[model samples]
Target: MCEWVNRIEYSLWTQHCDEGRRFGHMTKNISECMNSILKGVRNFPVCSLVKATYGRDNSEFTVAETTLTDSFSLGSYRVSLASQTCDCGYFQALHFPCPHALACCAYSWLTWEPYVHQLYRLNSVFSVYRMGFTPPISEGFWPPYDGPTVIPVPNKRRAREGRPTSTRIRTNMDEADPNRPKRCGLCRQPGHTRRSCPQLRGAEHTRGHD
Candidate 1:
């Protein structure tokens, strides 16, 4: 069953899916085979995992061409140089260029940097992470104060009761007699049995009525 699923995955990746993700130039299964590559790293330490992920992303940036995929930037883009419009609707929508526009510019030898917004550049990225995070100090290093420690009042505390009852408590459902009759057997009336029926004491009722 697992092998069948793997074959399906290999087919989808190599043959490409309908959602437009394809290896445009390549006609072979990826050399490393993603499942095999990732399986080994599944149990990597947290730091190693983060490092691996960051390194993987950076490696993707080195590859000039990329397949159009949902994870890339949302929608697939149509880049046309003549009209300078991208169907992704990002270039005109934000007027701040995107990867699709950059790809087009790069293809035409027309300097992609100008189209990319300055705030999205490497300098801006470097600026954001320039300051290292301040290290956390131990709790003991926190300032000491003379204020009374906030605690529950002695009277508010629950009585340290004796050992709890070992037996389970009975609920109404458990105590109810399932054998009890729905109607009185003696009177053929609702609500009680022959033993507890008021109709069974008809002579006494007659005397009271008299």
Candidate 2:
């Protein structure tokens, strides 16, 4: 009887036990929640983006928990933070407080706007065009130099018989910048960068005049 009991316990442990069961897949769970939120929200055009140029208030905020209200309305779908957002699709996509988040704000009085921003809306995502600049006017005008000196076009070498004429070669122009100034990011000075700064290197003797 004891031997039979031991065998049964060993079989259960070996066959049924799993390490993954003990440790939950948090990443998968979060991804699934995001997917659910996306599916529920209605779609919006990407070009209909709002210009959020100026920075938001940097004041520190306290987080508040909001309870779901009965019979909440979110466009087509009912409101559910448990579902992570409403059917309107505002809460999840922007990651900032939407109308539903505002409702949550009213109930909790905990500043749902901050939560909407902190959890979902990343500043980095919006920063893509923050430092955007117009392309500089090219010094090389159209209808390039009609100079007198007749520079003959170099003739291509004849391809070997039965060999392909096409060949792929990498160019250094990718790394080379014509307009990029040879200046340092630190101290906004010219010549060596901050990384190679003598001042930073503690070599006072090597520090040159401004």
**Per-candidate local distance difference test:** 0.62, 0.53
Candidate 2 per-residue lDDT, tens place, 115-209, comes to: 45553456757776698789877887656776888665656656568876656675785566878777776667777898987567676555654
Which sections of candidate 1 miss by over 4 Å? 1-85, 92-108, 131-134, 141-182, 185-188, 191-210
List pairs with backbone clashes in candidate 1.
none
Per-residue lDDT tens digits of candidate 1, residues 17-48? Answer: 52535534244456545544456576988787
Q: In model 2, where is the ten-residue run with the lowest total lDDT?
A: 51-60
Q: How do all models score by TM-score?
A: 0.27, 0.25
Per-residue lDDT value at 173 in model 2: 57
Ten residues in a row with the worst lDDT in model 1? 65-74
Candidate 2 has an lDDT of 0.53
